[model samples]
Target: MSPLPGIVGALLVLGGCMVGLRLLQRRYHPHPELVRKLMHLCVGATALSFPLLFHDPQPVWWICGVAIAFMLALKYVSPLRALLGGVLDSVDRFSLGDVYFLAGVAVLFTVSGGGLTFTIPMLVLTFADALAALIGVGYGRLRYPAADGVKSLEGSVAFLTVAFVSAHVPLLLSGATGRAESLVIALLIGILVMLLEAISWQGLDNLFIPLGTFVVLNGHLDRPLELLLFHLAAAVTLTALVLLLRRRLGLEGSALLGAAFVAYLCLTLGGWPWLFAPAALLAGYALLAHRSRLPGDIHALVALTSPGLFWLLLAVYGRRPELYYPFTLSFAAQLACAAALALPADPDGRVRPGPLAARVGLAWALVFVPYAVLLGAGGLVPALHGLCVTAVAALLCLALRRARRLSFELQTTLAATASLFGLAPLGA
Candidate 1:
């Protein structure tokens, strides 16, 4: 019952599994992916026993820490790599999945104290993720681009189905949530995490799926049926709209789905006002930029929206109203920068300042005017101040582009800077 025994036993089990996997690989010569999935299931299932074995989280943390350290050593240490290569290292893809798996276990245990929240995510990560991989490889025919590679739609659907069942059956059996609410919550989690996994690059899904499921499941545990239904509707509608207009929006595959999920969070977390800025920016970009000029990848979308996302979280969860202005300003700045860069250039491959200024002005107005109108007379000062700062940021970004050829990094930096300066008028 004590943590010390559980910790020792868990460590031993981990060690045994590794050695057994190595021996099995040597004798049977199973596929590398099959070996990796075996490791995933064995380790994750062992971790599931933590709540039963130890009363405190410290022991679980110790096991996870030790496992992570040993796995790291196994990857790099020549003798260990040679010994374990057929197990984890033989897979051809670049993945930090093994490390992320251990880290997710530690994080989930700490956050949920090894309750249903922890159990559900672990279940999804272990069973659903592994099944999806096997099914995708075996049955996948419809493929689309993910982060750096392609994934099958069949695999995504399998993940969604398994995740929904994994989340629903537990809540339904526990009787903590009503059947209908459980269904909604599970469906929502399935959809969101499926999208996350689809877009993830380099095994980041190992980390994102569990945490993202935790956030969704934890947030919706006791909500009313109507609210849960609304969330479900919102998610479905957003996904549909993104898919319908994917080409026009300059988004496809993982990028399209990622954008939809991101927008859904903004709407759900901070309501319509928060959603307005991104909506306007998206619409403005779709209208103004040529199809060739629009961003169609997750990396570019993150660069564009992360600044506003940062401010949105601060405003909503941190209960900082002033941060709302910064959130809107962040989007405005990004829109301005996007507009400036997207305009047509002269024969010399240079954009005239007049057209660039006009484009930026149009984008700024498209995004900010509605915001100003919504804020009424009192918000006029902050809106105008944000406008000025956004212009300066756009101009500065252009100068950098002219000098060094503009990069997503500069665009992100300017967006964040403009949002920070958006605080000045609030102070005044």
Candidate 2:
């Protein structure tokens, strides 16, 4: 089929699906999510046909653009709202899920040119997610916090089971991989995507799940079975370890899962030596949090670790060896700054600068010494450079500490900025 007819047909199918769902909703008045998931399944299933119907990506883009405009019209345009709003707007929570769904589908189709790589993510999104939601709403009893709302262990398990099937059946049917390799790949994708969904806020899951699935699948598609098994083991082991320390860490369930995802990314992409700083920070913070009852959540974790995550990406993805030290130092500075704040305050609830400075020095030494040793082993010596950077971070953190209102944010920013020290020509 040519692009024009394909675009028209695609739009017609999407419109028909929406209008059909609206009629069912008006007549039957089923649960909003049931109707929503029905729409999700229909649209996703229709999307699977794009690889065949249109040979080029232009038509897919056109279809997605039109659909997004129509979806927005349903939300805001009064006439369209009266006609089409019943199906989508029935839910109470705020969501741009429909919009994100269209966008993700378009991007995935374009990038993978619509093949097995595209098929699995779409299936996971279309089937696994829809089933998980319906099952979660009906049968889920063991609940915990997720993004803006709560999710059930039952729901997550459902998602994992369906995602595994979605990933496995395709690989097995295509005969692209052996059974053992297929099994390992499916398990890894299931665990990772489930965690992605668990931590997604708003309608971003529609965006993240497919893209994340593509990354995991494409990155490991050709690896040996041994590496695949190792990856699978690492994901499971990290998840288990985090859950075991959930209480001591003082992070919510979703936050803990987020931590596991970040840790896995670091370990797999950056290697064992790269894992030290974050692990040390987490361990020390977990100890202090348990002692002082300090609570940290997903938002806090993002704030503190985003910079280090950036540096890690640069070192690995951009092939910049110099940035590795910056990546490691960012975490060290983060730990040092955090530790300084954990000091015992005076009876009046004020922290003296002398004790604060002493605390910062002690904390930096504790975190950096081990990390520096690892860097030396890895053939990068930034020891003196790291010390100077950390001292500057501690001083800036001390200066920002008196701000009282924005202390944590200020200190975190300062610590991240210390990464500049690592940018100084490596050997110099």
Candidate 3:
């Protein structure tokens, strides 16, 4: 068989398999909405795979245009009304598949060179997105809402696992890297993609998953140490801002501020080192504040800002050696001050302790100390860093159980944060 025939055969097989899957879904599930989603996936996968087989962009464009026209016509026609209803409902129902498909296409187009550089990322997105949804929907008990309140833990795990496995397949098949190296790359990509998915709202994963995969595959970290320091700075700064704002603005506003800060940091400094900090803090605070309604909103502030304290310390001392000693002493002093403020002793007292406050403080401390230590150790033993984070997060969840009321906000936050830690090592 000629090379051309082989390529065509592969495409045919893939297309056939997808179509078969759609038929099965239609027959077994009989859910019009799900069937419509599968159809969209079919159309997209067909268009994308067309380019690879023909090696001509025109055929792919033509196919997409035709498909789009067909969809548009179906939108108006009465005979196709049943299909349209399904399509409309499916579109309304949020899933990450479209985003993954788009990302795969982007990676295919942007990476110039053939081979696995482009293909691996696309495969990762496809596999991860599909698997995450499958797992989350089928077996996921722990659900957390994304900014859009639509995402869940089951979906995230499916995404992470699929992405990892997808990336691993290409690495193994290409024979370009060792098992250990392939494992590391898979872990890194999986963790990074999962992080992006967790924080995304309202189908924004469409933008993030592709961008994140591109960044990781590109290996854009020229100065690992400096970039890491910048991430720490941004994380800390955002954490502080979230803490300060949660009381004044409330949950949505606090989250918005934190997100804006992260965007600014990524734009100026590059990467999202601070992504988890604000997410954890604001969510946790919102949970506690809603349940307890403690006065002065100090508990909310503490919960929101606690994650930052660790990032600040790591940035000043761990990331930047020049500022280490002075910053270390200053951080020690600050902790003492915070402790003193929370204590029952000041005569012209401003700070007052609440039941939730102490637990939040402890939880914050537990997460922070291990994160800092793991991050510090990451420079030498990357795997160990991942392990430390996982361990600490598990312990944090156990610790949170002691608190009287786990607000939806805090429960979601803790679950998401724990998910972050749980995912980190898999990608690493």
TM-score of each: 0.95, 0.94, 0.48
Please report, in order, the local distance difference test score of every candidate based on alpha carbons. Answer: 0.86, 0.82, 0.46
Candidate 1: lDDT of 399? Answer: 74
Worst 10-residue lDDT window for candidate 2 reads 287-296
Backbone clashes per model, in order?
Answer: 0, 0, 9
Model 2: residues >4 Å from true position, as ranges?
289-295, 347-358, 377-381, 425-428
In model 3, the runs with Cα more than 4 Å from the true position are 1-27, 31-52, 56-58, 72-78, 84-88, 91-107, 110-114, 175-180, 220-428
Ranking by TM-score: 1, 2, 3
lDDT string, candidate 2, 37-94, tens digits: 8998988998999988877778888888998998899999999899889787788788
Error of 3 at 362 (Å): 24
Best model number under TM-score: 1
Writing each residue's lDDT as its tens digit, candidate 3 over 1-428 gives 23456345544554465457545755686545345445444544444454456554434334434443444454557666454434433445555444344444544554434446656655655446545655665577876534545456667667878887877777778876666666666665675667666665555565566567666655522335454344445444654565466553344422433344443333333223333334433343344334332223223433434344434444544664322222222222222222222234234433344632454354344334434553575423433343344334433433444344434246335433433343233352
Candidate closest to the true structure, highest lDDT: 1
- Write one digit per residue (lDDT tens) for candidate 1, span 75-184: 88998788875688788888889899889888888898878999999999999899898888889999888878888899999999999999999999989799999999
